[model samples]
Target: MTRGGREKDRDDPERKCIATGESQPKAGLIRFCLGPDDQVVPDILGRLPGRGIYVSADRAQIDKAAKKGLFARAARQPVKVPDGLSDLVERLVTQRVIDLISMARKAGDAVMGYEKVKDWLTKGSAATLIQASDGSERGKTKLHPPEGNGGFIGVLTAGELGLAFGRERAIHAALAAGGLRTRVVEEAAKLAGLRGHLPTRAGGHDGGVTAMKDT
Candidate 1:
């Protein structure tokens, strides 16, 4: 299972996490590569050249790898790990997710606003539901995500969603079934793992979801 607790596809390529020493889908691990100066560089997009070293998406795992000489061991050379490596990965992954959502919006595969999202959900066109983590609990409860484990994303703030939709703030959004949806969910799962936990749903009728913030 992925960090998001979703089943992994058997066909997905797997990599060993230097932190956990466990094999998982490449998407569930953050890739790192050795730079010219032997610095450990995060391959968030998995496009950096050279041999890739992997760590689980969790922030603690990344920190463990950095503190335990795991990266150097994997590279078989001395490697410089930057200060706040987990923070760097979080920022990059968060941006990647936001950028993908923006691309989905431009492609007409994503929509924002309660009415539009609700319409898509009602019509069975929405593949995923997105809500701001800090949005009002009552407002968010009016809508539920599609029927699936990764169908809901409440990890992003209203301000973050605003950036994706080109607005000041966005409370609700939905993604249609497409390649973008898959990418968005996959990346969001990584973000969730890094953050430790996510707001899966409301606790009750009025209670809000609580995030397990990273220390």
Candidate 2:
């Protein structure tokens, strides 16, 4: 186990990003499949049938791949890339993260609202702190993230977070250990990298830019 009692995968599979030519964990890369029409499709779940093309989850890396014909090269054949593929991938990954968080909430391992989030932070129950990308900075700065890397996610909007927590809107939220917290963290990290900004608090502040989202 790593910090926070999180299990560390000893043999996590790695793939090389076509854009960066760097090998990293499969969880930190986005998978793509060549559709029947020779169109490149984002396989967010990595279940699509085709020769898989891997790319770093960051927007820059995806853009580079499209601009430089990396996908066709990787597929070893000409493939048509859909316009706005990056945005599509971002949306899909965001929805996946939301769904995971919603499941966590249903399992009673997640909570929303400023008071509840604050309580979790005080009790050290929060393994990750989530804030909205469009939230206000002053409001977000009031609460500190857990002391560790990968403990913060700030990419979803307040309304998006609200959906996960079953509320009209949520500016702050916390994820406790267990449930889907590990998946949430992994996916959120990718989303954060792709968006080129961390999720913001209610007062609006870029948490920090990082690497891409996962499947």
User: Tens digit of lDDT per residue, candidate 2, span 57-158?
Assistant: 889989999989999999888989889889999999989899999999999998887788999999999988987766656567788988765578877877
Query: Candidate 2: which stretches are off by over 4 Å?
Result: 1-10, 198-215
TM-score of each: 0.91, 0.85
Clashing pairs in 1: none
Off by over 4 Å in 1: 4-6, 203-215
Q: How do the residues 93-189 of candidate 1 rate in per-residue lDDT, one tens digit apiece?
A: 9999899999999999999998899999999999899988767777888998998767898878777787899987788899998758888888888
* lDDT, residue 41, model 1: 93
**Cα error, candidate 2, residue 136 (Å):** 2.9
What would you estimate as the lDDT of candidate 1? 0.84
lDDT of each: 0.84, 0.79
